[model samples]
Target: MALRRRALGLALGLVWGFAVMFSTLWLLFQGSSGEIISQLKYFYLGYTFGYEGAVIGFLWGFVDGFIFGVAVAWLYNYLSMKIYR
Candidate 1:
């Protein structure tokens, strides 16, 4: 069966986006934002270690996850079709 790329992408994006937002906020409130900032900085340049940075990270994560999920679903659907055919 073919996967719905857009639906998969949106679902993944929202989940990942919110997860990043909530997790970052949690760390910030818990006074552990520094560690996450350092880690994210290593992966994402110009990432501030504050609320603004968390918001930016959330957006980036959402876009990244959405694209990834779409690609994965597309590839799976294509391969499955070929195999079944």
Candidate 2:
């Protein structure tokens, strides 16, 4: 079946964004520290290591996931068409 690119993109965006938001919040609550989390601060616009960071990470994750999902879905559809034909 052909993938619905827009719907998939939105779905992935929301899921990934919320996941990142919650995970970051959870880690902060647990007082966790890591290189990855620190590095993520650079990827997330306006992200720090606290409450505001979660919000900023969510937005960045959403945009990043949406673009990635769209590209992946398009590529999958293109490849599937080629293979089937």
Candidate 3:
């Protein structure tokens, strides 16, 4: 079966964006900055363990996930077409 790149990208983008935003909020509520959350600042510029940071993380995550999902779907479709032919 062929995968739709746009659909996969959109799905992944939303999921990843929400995941990052919520995780950040959760940590903020807990009053502790986890190691992983802190490390995210390295990858996502302007990201911190704060309210604004959550939005930044979400945006970064969405873009990152979308690109990754699209690439994977494209590769899968291309390889499937080649192998099935």
Number of colliding residue pairs in model 1? 0
Error of 2 at 17 (Å): 0.5
* TM-score-better candidate, 1 vs 3: 3
Ranking under TM-score, best-scoring first? 3, 2, 1
Question: For residues 27-61, could you state the per-residue lDDT of candidate 1 as single tens digits?
Answer: 78888847645577676555667788778778877
Return the TM-score for each candidate structure: 0.86, 0.88, 0.93
Using lDDT, give the best candidate's number: 3
Per-residue accuracy of model 2 over 1-85 as CA lDDT, tens digit each: 8898998899899998998889889988888884467588777768777788889889988998899889989999999999998
**Predictions: Cα RMSD each:** 1.6, 1.4, 1.0
lDDT for every model? 0.80, 0.86, 0.92
Q: Ten residues in a row with the worst lDDT in model 3?
A: 31-40
Ranking by lDDT: 3, 2, 1
List clashing residue pairs in candidate 2.
none
lDDT of 3 by residue, 1-85 (tens): 9999999999999899999999999988998857778789999999988899999999999999899899999999999999998
Once fitted onto the true fold, the runs of candidate 3 whose alpha carbons sit more than 4 angstroms away are none
